[model samples]
Target chain A: MRNLFAFISGALFGAGLFISGMTDTAKVQGWLDVFGDWDPTLAFVMGGGILPMAVAWLLTKGRRPALGGEFPTPPAPKIGRNLVVGSVLFGMGWGLAGLCPGPSLASLSYGGFGHWLFVVAMLAGMMAAVPLRARLAEPAEA
Target chain B: MIEQDWIWGFVGGLLIGLGGAVYLLVNGRVMGASGIVGGLVDGSGMRTVWERVAFIAGVILAPIPIYPIYRTVETHITSNVAVIIAAGLLVGIGTRLANGCTSGHGVCGISRLSLRGITATVFYIGAGGITMVLFRHVLGVI
Candidate 1:
């Protein structure tokens, strides 16, 4: 049951990504390209997504998830170095490829070999992050 | 006054949010795509392996049926191998370090008014725009 719900949610999310034209690298690049032919569609997408999710957060308050576990709570909203540096790095990649994690995965069916290569590299990066994070955290711990 | 692309984007964004709502309310987990896959790669998500697999399966498979109806799904990912590798590594490392991406931080985090989410979004989008200007205009490499 838990897995089923998760799968449904994933499908909906992927379908949304596909229908929204976010799977298109050109469209995504257009959004980032403020100087060039700018695309405002992404703004609408963000607004549309935020409105419902804001309400969902409200609903989750004081209410346990329908499933058996407790709702996962967010940690303190800290403005940490990792967050800033990581985000900038992410943004650079996003601008370069016009593909983030969601769209990258969602578009795999038709994204061809280039997409496959990107995913493989991304996974490798993710693996690297484990050790990298540990090393970065060492200073703070010390 | 809404453009056709905007309409699609908005609707898709809403669906993505709705998917997030379901994930939170039913599965008691936030629908951060990178985190889901990252955990699997880093071996941190081994305990909930099935759930993660199910969600990923849904995301990948969702577009299969949509392809027939839409008839075309274009990703436009760049063919430049070097750029692809660099971008992929940055994205994977960045997202894992920051702990979210467009869907997770941009949608879920901002919706909850979490400072970390909002900050991350700003940095990433800002960085992406700058990178776009640099790469597309100055460097002309991407």
Candidate 2:
């Protein structure tokens, strides 16, 4: 039952990406173009996503845990250098490639060859981080 | 007043957001795509593995139903495969460094009114914005 729900939810997400035209690289690139044929599509997409999410949050507040038994959701982070640095890196990559991880994966199912490289490189990047994160934590242990 | 594209975008975002909410309400877990995927590799339980595999499969197969409805022409901004690969790698690393992707931190985290999610999202958006300025405005990629 849990697996079924997750699968359905994921399907919905992929459908959203495709319908929003987010899977299309041109639309993504258009957003990147500030002066040249600026496309507000991505902004619109994000805005659309946020509205319902806001309402859902309100509805679900104070509710007990539902799936996979009980677990406390992680605490939200305070604003800091991590936020700034991470955002900058994410935006730079998005602007350059017009693909984020979610849509990148979605695009792959649609025969999006562009996402092939993005997906590969993304996996590599994740793998690379295991050691870096370990190294960063080493000093804390010391 | 609504353009066809905007209608599609709005609907798509809503579905994705709603689906996310359903997952949270039912599972007590944030529907972070990367985390779900990651769980497949590292998670110990049989349930966890099944859920992750199902979710990923759903995401991959979602475009099939929608392909006939919106037949937008696909376009590629950068044909260079290397660039795409590099961008994906960067995102993977960034997600790991931050401890979540946009779906986990940006969508689920923010919805729960988490400070960390809000901070992570800010960075995620900021990164896209700055990268756009640099790539399109400064470097003239777009």
Chain B TM-score in each of the candidates: 0.97, 0.85
Best by TM-score: 1
The pairs that clash in candidate 1 are none
Backbone clashes in each candidate structure, one number apiece? Answer: 0, 13
lDDT assessment of candidate 2: 0.70
All candidates: interface RMSD: 0.8, 2.3
Instruction: Tell me candidate 2's fraction of native contacts, as a decimal between 0 and 1.
Output: 0.65
Question: Candidate 2 residues A60-111, lDDT tens each?
Answer: 6666646546544465345544445545566566667887777777778555
| TM-score to true structure, per model | 0.97, 0.86
lDDT of 2 by residue, B1-142 (tens): 7667777777887877876876767766677766665544333334668777777777778887777666753646487776677677777766766666767777677666788777777777666767777766787654
Q: Residue A113's C-alpha lDDT in candidate 1?
A: 93
* Segments of candidate 1 deviating more than 4 angstroms: A138-142
